[model samples]
Target chain A: MDNLKIERTKSTPYIFFDAASGRLRVEGESYPENVVKFYTPVLDWLHGYFAEGADNITLEFKVAYFNSSTSKVFMTIFDLLEEYVTTGRMIEVVWICDRDNDVSIECGEEFKEEVEQLSFRIEAC
Target chain B: MNIRSLYLEEEAVLKRAEGLLMSQQCFSLDVYRELYEEYRKLLKQMKTLVNVADLTQAELKTLSEELGKVSRIDGLTELYNRRYFREIFLHTWQQAVEEKDILSLLMIDIDYFKKYNDTYGHLQGDECLKAVAAEFQRAVGHPEDFVARFGGEEFVILLPHSDAEAAIDVAKRLLQNIENLCMEHSASPFGQRVTISVGIACRCPTSDVKPNTLLDEADQALYKAKAAGRNCFKLYV
Candidate 1:
């Protein structure tokens, strides 16, 4: 599978779903005009990755702010990772937040509580 | 000469009509003609008024359209508003059902909000709400996710192509982010720190599950979170 890289804009975030390194990194703020229209392709890529049997993935979320629509997309990514973990593959989620920002830390903790097999950790940057 | 003659002619006609009505004791053709002319004049005046009314109606419609464009807030809290959320939710739900993608929802609420409002006034309470809202907006990080301010101090996040466990994880992260804020809420039931409770629900777009039902399930989980504690999250069974 080919690597996917999306640059961040005023209205969107930076997305890097790398196939070779098995690292999916999403950074920046996301509040696009049409969120569903923007994320359909990203969801497709995740589906394609799973179908191709790519294992040993690490997902990193380094976001300052995003809209409710983006939250749903993050759920989709985590769900995919959960499936892979269920199949006996290792999946790790690294949640990065600023040191003083309790909001980000709390959000990371929330995501961690939901998943069972996937390893989840929160890091302050 | 012309003005004098015209005035004299009108007066003569009026006099003749009165005379005919009195002497003939019957309605004449000339009287009918004069009445018809008066009726035509009134009709023309009414037509002009009607045209002005139509113009005012058109102007009002244009003003309303302009106001809608300027006054409507598409997204609040840096997330989608209820209006945008409903549109995307329906669209994504349909697509996920058709394509067999994972779909999920998370309902989030501020813990001890009433206490917060009591301790810090509604102004500060609103500030806290805005801060948390910004955090939720940042969490999704993708276009596919839908985050919306469901109501005061409450938010809903939609995750497509996700499962139950992942949805739970996201909820946990949101809780952690808010907790880390350390926004002092002395009146809170959960201690000095302000926190949130989240409820999560996920579906694979099965034939049995509808979008509203999924939301209801998530809301139930949110209720469970509130029941268990003010700062925890739960996933629907």
Candidate 2:
């Protein structure tokens, strides 16, 4: 599978998903003008990656802020991770938040609860 | 004079005065006094009307100004509003193009907001929107970045000299922040958590393309995100 690279914008984040290392990293503030358009390719890439039966996926999310709409996209990513984990592939999600932001910490917790199979960690960055 | 006779006499005197005035004869000082009194009374009434008209005009001007202020403000989030957004967007876009800087936009919407509003009361839904708006404001920290509550549960963030990568980082942070809020809505299909969908559009502003086109592209990206799922970010190619 080819690597997935997304350039960030003022209203969105940069996404780098490496198929070989199974490492996916997203970093930036996200409040896109159009949420679906920004996230679709990422979602499609994830779908294709999972279909390829990738192993040992490490997804790191370093976000400063995302609007409610972007939260839904995060959920989709988590859902994909969960699917991979259920299929016996190892999945790790690292959620990075600012040290003082209680909000990001809680967001990580929410994802942790939703995806049962994937290992989720909340880190202060 | 007797009271009745005095009234008649007064009437007769008034008639005589009228006759004298009609004949252009010299009038009594008393008659002149009476005419002056009548003139004064008429002048007083006219003066009152004029004062009332002036006050009414002043009040109207004040009301019009207040209305203008209200209309200028964004109704939903009470932000600087969309009218201001257009002015700033054009200026920022122009500046970016001239400086050869990247201008990025994020169009965001509350995921399943309509459903959320339907399930919870509009009051609760409004609270959700307020919380989201506050989160967006915090995310776009740069002085040059313009964040406006565009409409409904949607918002737009404009970042000047910001590339796609920088915007994505901001978007991710915002996504994580809202998740942390832990506001529960059981009715949400996305689980107890409330989420959003974002669309990102970035380019060096150019003479050929208007800012609205960039916004439209971002909006298109957002639609793709929604189509794929309730939560996520999609970027315009």
Candidate 3:
């Protein structure tokens, strides 16, 4: 499997997925003008990898700010992770939030509560 | 496994990627082609969606601009309101002091306006105020000159980089403009028509003075104009 590296822009976040090492990460602010357009390929790649039946997956997130549309996309990704874990696959999610920003901390906590199948941890930075 | 830059969405490039992934392990060539084709269809759909988003963002920008303009305007006079006037004058005062340039202010009021409002009803009084405000708005000649509705029956004009002479010219033009309109005010002593009293103040702004100082000087001059009899302009010395 190949590693996926997408560069960050003013509106979109950086994505670095090392499929071989099983370390996937998304970092930076995400308020893209076209949320669905920006993230469709990312979902496609993740689904492709999942088809091969992964043993263990660790997804890390370091998001500063995101809008309503981007939140919907994040929920979709969480749904995929839930599906993966339900099949007895080991999936760990690490969501990073700045200590001073309560909104982001709340978002991470909500994700933890909502996605039951995955082991989700909120790490304050 | 090779690292790939993921922005590229060409069909040929995606097909090659699918070939590489299929070569890795279990995916057959036919299955890989189907996956690649599906991805290509998704990219085309995203392009269409992005075009729609661009239109929505443009409309949002226009709406915000209109809202900002509305906030800065006085609804009755259709001129810049007191808050916007104060915000701009403070900055202009600072700039004038830094550059050591001249600044002028004109504080104007309608003669016997309270009596006029009493005699003609508040509705007609509002119409008279609107007409007078339009005259003052027309008298402002330069882009740097601004006129604002200061309060009931009072208006203020700010002229940046204007000397005493230029300000007097503006005052004269404002008097002529209002006179030409010939708005009726039966309660006025100045004339049969509504007329305005103006007080002019000018300063080569310095670090020691503030915006309120200019306003106070103009107010004192306006009092002097009233004492000297209405329908005339007084310059603060």
Candidate 4:
């Protein structure tokens, strides 16, 4: 599976997935006009990575702000990872939040609570 | 990966899902339960997202208001800056005209401030300016009165409903306050202690009279005050 790389915009986040290292990173704001259209390639890359029999991967999320549609996309991504975890794959999810932004920290905590099987950790910086 | 190809692939998946939902006649009890749980989780996430956005919006509003106030204030003296003063001065002038009240402007300068800076160094000169600014702030008791840093070593006070006599009383009070401070200004020819020169201009503003007219008159009076001698005030006749 080829790695996915997309630059960030004023209302979107930067996406980078490394096939060689099995590391994925999505950072910055996410409020794109068409949320589903923007994240389609990212969802495709994740599906392909898991289908290619990848055993372990680390996903990092450093999002400052995101709209409701972006929230739904995040829930979908979490469901995908949880499915892989239930199939006996190790997936580590790290959510990085700003220390001063209580909202971002709270959102990360909410996501962590929703996923049981996946190793989801919230970190503040 | 080609983005177009990936987008097409996801579109196909979405179409398939739509078809599955359309064709499905009934779902098993376990499937229904799982869907209900997912719906609840989504609702909870949605609530958090909305709350986060609201808080961020409110925080941004407060930050912008604070930035506005900071921009209008002088950093060293904590007085209204010249630009902001100019904006509000016009409003004050208009209000005085509408009310048919006397408006007075006092142009004040520190006597031989350059010499003070040279003798005591820039740091002490800054302290002197701050002290004088504080004294001016304390002396202006009226709620409608405004004090501003007109520029380097110069300050202006706007007095509403005051005539020449009232303006002179304010000048006297300011001079007395500076004397109480008793700041040493060895290089000043005016006196051993720091003193200020004030120029007073009073008028009942009219619609035809521009706001700048009063300001110019005050400036001219300040020049006369300096020429006559420092450390005292002179009223524009």
Most accurate candidate by TM-score: 4
The chain A TM-scores for the candidates, taken one by one, are 0.92, 0.93, 0.95, 0.97
> How does residue B68 of candidate 2 score in lDDT?
84
**lDDT (10s digit) by residue, model 3, range B1-237:** 111222333445667776877778776779768776657544544443344344445556877999999989999999999999999999999999889889999999999999988999999999999999999989988998999999999999999999999999999999999899988887887567899999999998788876799999999999999999989899999
* Candidate 2, backbone clash total: 71
Q: Rate the local accuracy (lDDT) of all candidates.
A: 0.76, 0.78, 0.83, 0.85
Please say which candidate is ahead in DockQ: 2 or 4.
Answer: 4
* 3 against 4, candidate with superior lDDT: 4
Using lDDT as the yardstick, the better of models 1 and 2 is: 2
Best by DockQ: 4
Q: Which structure is stronger by TM-score: 3 or 4?
A: 4
Which CAPRI tier for candidate 3?
incorrect
Error of 2 at B225 (Å): 1.3
Model 2 DockQ class:
incorrect
Error of 3 at A42 (Å): 22
The Cα error of candidate 1 at residue A53, in Å, is: 92
Candidate 3, which segments miss by more than 4 Å at Cα? Answer: A1-125, B1-28
Model 3 clashing residue pairs (backbone): none
Q: How close is candidate 4 to the true structure, as a TM-score?
A: 0.81
What interface RMSD do all candidates show, one decimal each? 33.9, 39.3, 11.1, 6.2
Note the clash tally of each candidate: 48, 71, 0, 0
